[model samples]
Target: MSAEKIDLLNFLQAHPPFDQLPQQALEQAASNMDVAYYKAGSQIVELGQLLDTWHVIRSGSVEVYRRSGELYNRLSEGGYFGEVSLLQNRPSRFPVIALEDCLIYLLPKAVFSELFDSYEYFSDVVEVEDRSRLRHSVSQREDANQLMTASVKVLLTPNVLSITETATAHQAAIKMSENGISCLLITDLQSQICGIVTNTDLRDRLLTPGLALDTPVNQIMSPRVFSVEHNQQVFEAMLLMLRHNVHHLPVLKQGSAIGIITLPDIIRYETQNSLFVVSSIFKAQTLDELVSLKADVRACFVRMVREDANSRMIGGAMAVIGRSFKQRLLELGEAQLGPAPVEYCFVAMGSMAREEQLIVTDQDNAFIFDDNYQPSLHGEYFAQLGKFVCDGLAACGYSYCTGEIMASNPKWRQPLKVWQQYFSQWIDQPTPEFLLNAAIFFDLQPVYGKSGLVKQLNQLIRYKAKANSRFLACMARNAILRTPPLGFFREFVMEKDGKQSNSINIKRRGTAPLVDMIRVHALAIGSKAHNSFERLDDIIESKLLPNGRAEDLRDALELISIVRIKYQAQDLELENEPDNNIEPEALSAFERKNLKDAFQIVSDAQKFLRFKYQPGRAS
Candidate 1:
């Protein structure tokens, strides 16, 4: 090959779709590739114009636009455009312009057609075009079959009614009749959610029992309340109701009930197989029963993967199952120990809180006792409760936190004031140890009990961490520790330990660093969102990062997460133990090539983190 063709071949081998092509095909492409340049702000392709070549950016940036002139996508070096038009042999569907002075490589229409027609990899890559993998992943989850795309708040009645748990059944029935509603949320004296009472409960526990109309509503109310977040999906609410076999479900936002949903509401929406798994979880009456249901959980996971659910949808569904396990465990715990002496919230931290949990994850949870809690008086009761839940979780496939972060650890089970002190100390002082603890503790959401305690703790971290420069600097420094798994020459960096040698722990190398850096940014921006994707939205809105960098980071995170999710799903499908470690050599050429690009994005984001925070160099 000539020197020019060699250079072109090297460039083609470094980018996607082309990188996956056979060596002979690549040489053919490089030999025929034509190069051209355009000045910054010059039009490369116009709307409705016929195109004979597929334009790929070899240098500089470009912007693709729709016919109506809305910004479609911003592309940097190695980003390709004009594939859609070339594929269809139609007019240029999206106009393209050079955002900066650009060097472009034109692949002839004949060669483009040959590669796309013969190679599935090329076809798939080109189909993404300006929409990119991020859009493709999201669209997969929001398709016609996925009910999780719509929010639960949409199904709620405009006006919801509530009655005190102390009120008589007659009073609740009268109110329900007057409002023409089927259910009423039962609240305690403090107006906190105590339970939910529905017409079914009245019919079964009151009318059919020949009980007096003046009986207390609590007598018939289901104390084990199953609720969904208003921000949660209609399908998720449906699943909760299915799991517990309850018709009335309370919708909560920020720990307070906002509305209620019923079975008919979800029937009008869509149904998924995952809901049936969740329903089965609540039906388990014993620890053995819960443990035996693990196979069904795996089945649900594999089914969703087969049905083409994206990482977000699968992760959200799995997180709900995990939380339901915790919820049911708590119910079992309460039943085993009877009523607790003091109120407390069982908080799930880390991946569970972020709603990105996969099948292979450890339990990271803590307890937040009420302010009035006295360890001297209530210590034993809480300890038993903690062990019951944690042990039950372990039995249900969630491994115990190796770091001992569970509530079973006495140090983690503390009163609200003590927990506040812990958060305050972690932020204000921020030693290496505290920063490590903060990483897990910072991303917490309550799974059961008085969740308001969790809300207060979250508010404390949001305001305090945002204002504390030293704390953020230390956090950024900690985040920079786990860099992406790519060597200086862009080769895969293999693990050196034990049986996993020569493999990469994707979580530790890819998702961890990305999530850690994003968390630092989210904290600095005072974003309360826990999931990395959600946090990126807040960061993007705040303009905390440079233009297009936020989206790049978001796309990078999503891609990396999807890779990890895919492997775990694969393991489950094969009936093997699910794991985070992945061998690059085991991946197909397409995946191996794209993984390197994703790792490079991680490296770039880490460099930005160091420069932005400056850590020790801040002075």
Candidate 2:
């Protein structure tokens, strides 16, 4: 190979679009390319310049800016520069200028067309972009910090080793020896967090003091818990343990104890290079690499389920990793087109924004920029970021919301004042459409940029809703629409649909009803735990649900969660579909019975909510 061809070939083997090309084809691509170098601040493509070549940065970065002097995006090494011009076959809308001394591989339009025609995968990047309409508004992010988990089946331990909070000190010790662990968590009768006893506590407190074996476990169990949510990285778990000077921590969902995490468990989960990509995602230089790391994310979830990881732990970890990816994507976007004169915070609205994502989820996002942004200065920057994030997420395996709730919608990306106006209008005149499905907005959490903005807005929402009886009633009435699945005879009801269409609809009938009910309760109480589980806990404390009812609802929610998890695991195993649906026929009689009772409990709560909110008649 010629010297130029050899250098270009090596470069192609490393970058995407060409990285997917086979060796011989890549060589042909390299041989067909011409190389060019640019000095800092040099213009590679001027505005009104006719379409020419597709330029790839082999080294250094280029800033794509409008001739009107507005900065567009920063494309660095291994990034393509003139795609816009090459794509439309017209004058460049954005001029490409070298931000630093740069090495660029210039592929003429003819050669690129030939390559695209030959290689099928080469067309995906464009196809993915062209078809991805909701993609142009949100900036993508990547940050890799790992807590260990399995990428394959992990060894699960059994023998039902656990201790009751009422168990005596002697029983705790005996159980520890029997199970061979230094630490044991005290589970309450309700299966919530109670306390923990380490082997050190066992030896130091019991043996040292010669305490009676019959003393309650709670008496000696050190209650200083440094816990993490489930599915949180083992690294985060380790850090929490280290910071709290605790050896064990309990993981909770909706304020109920779910599992335990320890330093040793951390070490075991991330065994065999699990931490490598977990750490590398943040260091990725290009968007392509971020897309690649997401594959590992799917692998982690698959592995977590295979290990029989509880839903709380699995969801917690996935939330963290998903946040990391988006955070990184945002960082890259901001670095490329941010620090603008105006303040803009990217809001992840649905699963992502709320730090709750299922294995197969849809994107929900919106932008809240400072109202003072001068159109001439910040519009393009925010626009580009919105586009990048929405698009990048789709590439990372989150299907675009069919409902078009993404930040890419110009209607959603607006100034904070505008957002307030939007919410105020939506709240004041809560229509059936808003009530039926708009709770996704209620679960809003700031995932990136200016969390204070989200905080301020949340405060306003509480202030507005607390006194707006009509609005509250509307929300509550809507919340009760999905009444618990109690039958006329109060029997456990399953889906009427058989094999093919049958599904218990855990998310819809079970979790969402309770979740929405809790949201209304939270609005009344102004609770900060927007999540259904956490919000329910707050409701329990607020005395909204009668003590007995609260207890029942908690158990119902837990059962729903546990049921969802088992189904999810089975789905992964079959490599069938991964969804929230549960077939009624698949359930054991006990499960079906329990699910029905759970459904009834939620339905009762729904009735209470509807009565409280009186649909048409009011006091």
Candidate 3:
């Protein structure tokens, strides 16, 4: 082979379909490949054009548009196009344009057909829809870990044992013993599972406290029952158990208890280091003790990444761990400062609220006081409480919010009425400043205290923000301000002035922009969901975007988040401080290509957002 053909073969071997091909087939395909180039904004294949050669993007990017001129897809380096038209032996249905100056590999019709006819996997991939292809790529990344794929049903113990809430504690214990179970579900008179009592509960609530055996099981049981749907992933069940510090989770199917899963059940599937870290966090008594677990937190993060946990699972687990820290710190704070002066809700904002937190995150929190709260009287207590929580969070791995959006800032700490008014004002009159605040504050979830306070605030946001077109438009504008770090020619545009010069802050440019865009859609659709992936589900159901757009955004967010997470894990492995900034050279060939595709999706989503919410348009 000539040097050029050899390079082509190597490039093809690194990418999919071709990568799946046998070596002989791959070399033949590469040798027969003819090269073409297109200038930026130039059309490669017009709609209805007769197509023969299958075009693969060797470098640069292209935009594929439907017959109606709507964007169908974006293909970056290692991405291929023209297979659809060629396979059908028909005119091009989707037009292809160079998104940037491009290097294209043109596989002859004969070679392309031969490969497709001979290889089932290659044909299967090439023939799948774009969203399916993206999902396949994501699934491929996670396929190595059974925890990602295995359902909670697999871990459930047979014949879930239960006792009526009216049953005595002795009866519950006897039932558990008879069934060889550690826990028994407590059901109400309607036969609906209501609570759970474990051997530990039996020991602590009955044996240690010397409660009468005739006491109602309801009195001894944990009223707040945490559970999993039978079909949920095992990791989700693990997270629920870790988040709530529960030992047993009743696995329900269609509102009926089928079986139960325990901590030991999850441990059988994978390492329980994250669960242990959370357990330790809740067990820690002092700020110093909580601070000491920072290393454990990092180790947990690294382990999750190494284990092939997807971005959502890892993020949810980390957020649970983070909330544990806050919860433990609040317990300690109350010990020193006494009970709260008034009912208040400690709210986590941004990534934590979204359950998309990573190891390298800052604390974004606030307090919502009851409307009846008297600031003059209650102010000192909350101020101390806020300082205690924020300082403690900083002592742990979560640094203080750079913008001072923490509870420590009195601006963020406010009464429930004031919080509602704040949301109303931000929605009704969204200046650039308020829009910035909305981006962070809108994704709020209560971590502790009177959660009703936060609920009122969230209800106000969902009701007002969705109905206000001006606010949504302004938010859409703010969302696009930080564009993906892609230059005109589809190359990475790095940060030039920071200490981490020539690197990209993946969170800032990649995931954050995607989140910002998704948040706009979520607010526009009145979605109550906080997490980006869940919001996408709501958005998709609402049919707010063009077909496949929400899925594209989802794939983009997941890809970008995982890349950012993996980079942080790499940093931790090297014993260096983890940060969001990622050097382009540090990414593998596969990562760089997929990241470019993901970034392009973000850029496109931003454009659609701008078009969908024109500033002057009515709601």
Off by over 4 Å in 3: 1-272, 616-619
| lDDT for each residue of candidate 1 in 1-619, tens digit (9 for 90 to 100) | 5788888888888998788788888987887789999998899999999999988889888878878775566677788888777767799978889877899999899998898888776775666443333343355342234464456755777577888988999999999999999988889999988888888999999999899999999999888888876656666777777787888888875577777888976764332357776787788898898898787777667656654566777778889999999999888888888998888999999998998888899999988999999989999999998999899899889999999999899999999999999999999888888999999999999999999999999999999999988889999999988988899899999999799899999999999998899999999999989988899999999999999888888777777888888888888867789899999888865467668878898899889999999887423
Q: How do all models score by TM-score?
A: 0.63, 0.55, 0.61
lDDT by residue (1-619, candidate 2, tens digit) is 5786777777788877787677877877777778889998898898888866888888887777766764555566677866656767778877888877898888889888777778766765554333222121221212222233221113222222467888899888888888777778777898755678889887788878998878888888887656654334455566777777776666653364555556676555553222444566678888898888765776577665554444555556666666666777888887888565677777776555444456767787787887786657677777788788889888877678888887778777788887788778767778876654457787778878788888878888888877788888888777776765566987545567756354567787787777677778888888887656677778888997666676677667767876887787678768777788877778865576667767878888877777777755422
Best by lDDT, which number? 3
RMSD from true fold, candidate 1:
18.8
Please identify which of the two predictions, 2 or 3, would achieve the higher TM-score against the true structure. Answer: 3
Candidate 1 whole-model C-alpha lDDT, 0 to 1: 0.84
lDDT of 3 by residue, 161-188 (tens): 7789999999988888887889988889
